[model samples]
Target: MKSNIIRSVLSATALGVLSSSAMAHGDEEHAKPRTFDASKVEATAFGQEGNPKKVSRVIHVGMSDHMRFSPATISVKRGETVKLVVRNDGQILHEMVLGTKEALKEHAELMKKFPEMEHADSNMAHVKPGKAGEIIWQFTKAGEFEFACLQPGHFEAGMVGKVLVK
Candidate 1:
């Protein structure tokens, strides 16, 4: 009887895990864009609004499997429209999201809760292993900001960088 009970518990646990995985990945909401509120986001941060055609310059950055970003520090001029040419040289997924420290932490928390979540924004770039992406952003404000990869354990692994706008 004890063996039967143990089997039942294991089966139930497996089912629960499978169901939650399906729920997280199969939900249409997971793929929906999590739009940011322009007014409440941050003052010195670049808003997710830009035209790539008008990009003033392009900055190249690389991501490694060690959970670090190369050229982790970047700077731009105020009112500059720049394109971030990001590449994932890692063996796993990676992303680059721009925001203030507080905002980034909040967004990273949300990403942890809904790991399958995805969004299309100018201030963000997502790249798969051995892939590259770009984010064209207009630095409207002059201040320090952060860029991070909020994919589950990536952010916790210190996949973050600084952006200085002057």
Candidate 2:
């Protein structure tokens, strides 16, 4: 009788596990995959209407003929929205490329492959002299990133800034 009771309990435990696994499988069958609509996404300039100004820390990056960025070091909280307004005060085209240091290094190499490669994401922008551009980014991770100009040896010329997100 004692052995029979033990066997019954073991059978019940096995059945419970099997039932849960079956239920999980059923849930997967009923689950719907998430989809995104590209048309629903729109790009808005920073400080624009209809888009609430994110609690952003603004950084005014100025480029000059000597290939340099003013205020080369900036600090911000991790995950805080940042509004980087890049102004080219020089006579030539300049850009503000923001990314991880490694990413920027890789991008510099990729730029060699495609001379026209420009920052086209929501997190980066390119600007020309006498013109201004803005990039709204929220650094989700705490790390050191560099904002530089990949305009043909501009970075080597010292057109770079240190972005500390922490």
Candidate 3:
């Protein structure tokens, strides 16, 4: 009986150690650099590309009078890199925010409360009229994301687009 109990305890301890080691291995794998395929990136809407792949996919969006965006639908593949060139042809300041639908919804609410809640990270780019800016994004997952102008009532006025990443 004593030997059996000792064996059981040793087995349990071994399992615990193995489990911890497996978790650590998973963490290490997650730390590795991820690659996004350029071929998978499809240009659903573009303004006028000097060179589609070389000059980057240029998306010429117009923000005029309260809210508006040209070519409001875009498609892409999962794990793809895209360079979005946003041009503001309006008279007011505009911004382009790229994020998940949920993220955009939440941000919209936050912006409603605080008009200065602009995401200045890699996910968003702000440009003034007659000016152009770029946003390089890698769609890591397959889902529907939203690209919108979060300038107060812009999104409500049809200044939003769908980014289908599949």
Best by lDDT: 1
Model 2: worst 10 consecutive residues (lDDT sum): 25-34
Question: Per-residue lDDT tens digits of candidate 2, residues 79-153?
Answer: 577677788899877777776675566556545544443234454556656877776666666778788887767
Task: Give the runs in model 1 whose Cα sits over 4 Å from its true position.
Answer: 1-44
Return the top candidate by TM-score. 1
| Winner of 1 and 3 under TM-score | 1
Ranked by TM-score, top first: 1, 2, 3
After superposition, the stretches of candidate 3 with alpha carbons farther than 4 Å from their true spots are: 1-60
Residue 133, model 3: lDDT of 74
Question: Which sections of candidate 2 miss by over 4 Å?
Answer: 1-52
The lowest-lDDT stretch of 10 consecutive residues in candidate 1 is 25-34
Cα lDDT listed for each candidate = 0.73, 0.62, 0.59
Q: For each of the candidates, give the backbone clash count.
A: 0, 0, 0
Clashing pairs in 1: none
Writing each residue's lDDT as its tens digit, candidate 3 over 11-66 gives: 56445544553332111221222233455443322211112344334456555655
TM-score of candidate 3 to 2 decimals: 0.61
